[model samples]
Target: MSLLVCESFLSIQGESSFAGRPCAFVRLTGCNLRCRWCDTTYAQEGGGTARSLDDVVAEVRASGLRLAEITGGEPLLQAETPELAARLAGLGLTVLVETNGSLDISVLPPEAVAIVDMKGPSSGEAERMDLANLARLRARDEVKFVLAGRADYQHMRELLPRIDTARNTVNVSPLFGALAPAELAAWMLADRLDARLNLQLHKLIWPPDARGV
Candidate 1:
């Protein structure tokens, strides 16, 4: 089977607990939701190569990286994603699938580390998030909330207590250029929220717009 691949390249993981790690990223094409602050809007459509699973795996291996991330416009929208994840894992690469939390996370390979993007109020797609994904999250998995301001932070704050975070990691990232990092840091500190504050490390290390890093 083949996957509609937007772009595949090696770069430092920009967010989540795995940030700063060298990773091979497979950015898939198309998305069902439109968020106002989306940085990868170009990935929405019209710019992808239909690649066979074997070709995708070969490119990841050629990157000389052990960690491979299947990201998107929305990876789960592709039916072959689970097979792709299993194939990469079969090759001994740790697979991380970054998905917007609108689909079923349980459908992915059990060995694949899922990074679920839980949309916050400012994203406009917050209501579209599938809350059930939080229940499927495991110790190796992560749930991220990108906050745009105090209201979004407060919304996430309230949403946290209902989530069983004992097994999974929680990541709170301030929307780039929209929310100040220090502001979010201070809010988390005062609230004593048990979540990691993640910066888009790749953006800091390289220009934010630079692709295929």
Candidate 2:
């Protein structure tokens, strides 16, 4: 099977809990929602080089890294994504999938770790989140919230306790340049929130607009 792709390159893991680790990125094309603070709006299109499963695997493997992240404008938009993820896992590579929580993720392969991004109201696209996906998550999966300000943070803080954190890991990241990390950290400390803080390590290392790793 083939899939649309935006760009594929080897770079440091920028977000989530695995920040700063070397990773092979398969940035698939297209997204279902348009968030206000979206950094990768470039991925909102559906056209890109169409590569077969083997071709994609070869490109990732050639990077000489055993870690690959199948990220997207929203990867689950592609029907073959589960197959692609399984293929990558079959190669013994540690595979991680970054997905918007608005899609059904239950179809993905067992070995692939899911980094599910749960949209908050500040994103202006929170209603799209598929709440059912939360029930399907395993211990290898994680849920993330990207906060833009105090309102978003407060909303998420109230929602966190209702979520089953033991079934999956949870992460909270402030939108870069939109929210102060130190201030958000202080609030988290004060509330004694169980979530971990995440920073975009790649933006710290590379220019924000740069592509192709």
Q: Give the best candidate by TM-score.
A: 1
lDDT of 2 by residue, 75-178 (tens): 99999899989988988998999999899889899999999998889899888888778778877888888899998888787667656876667888888888
Measured by lDDT, the strongest candidate is 1
Error of 2 at 56 (Å): 0.1
lDDT of 2 at 68: 91
TM-scores of all predicted structures: 0.97, 0.95
What clash pairs does model 2 have? Answer: none
> lDDT per residue, candidate 1, 1-213, as tens digits?
899999988888999988999999999999988998998888888789999999998888888899999999999999999999998999899899999999999999898999999988888999999988877887799889999999899888877975667777889998888889999999989988899999989888988888776
Instruction: Indicate the residue-level lDDT of 162 in model 1.
Output: 59
Relative to the true structure, candidate 1 has a C-alpha RMSD (angstroms) of 1.0
Error of 2 at 62 (Å): 1.6
Evaluated against the true structure, the overall lDDT of model 2 is 0.87
Clashing pairs in 1: none
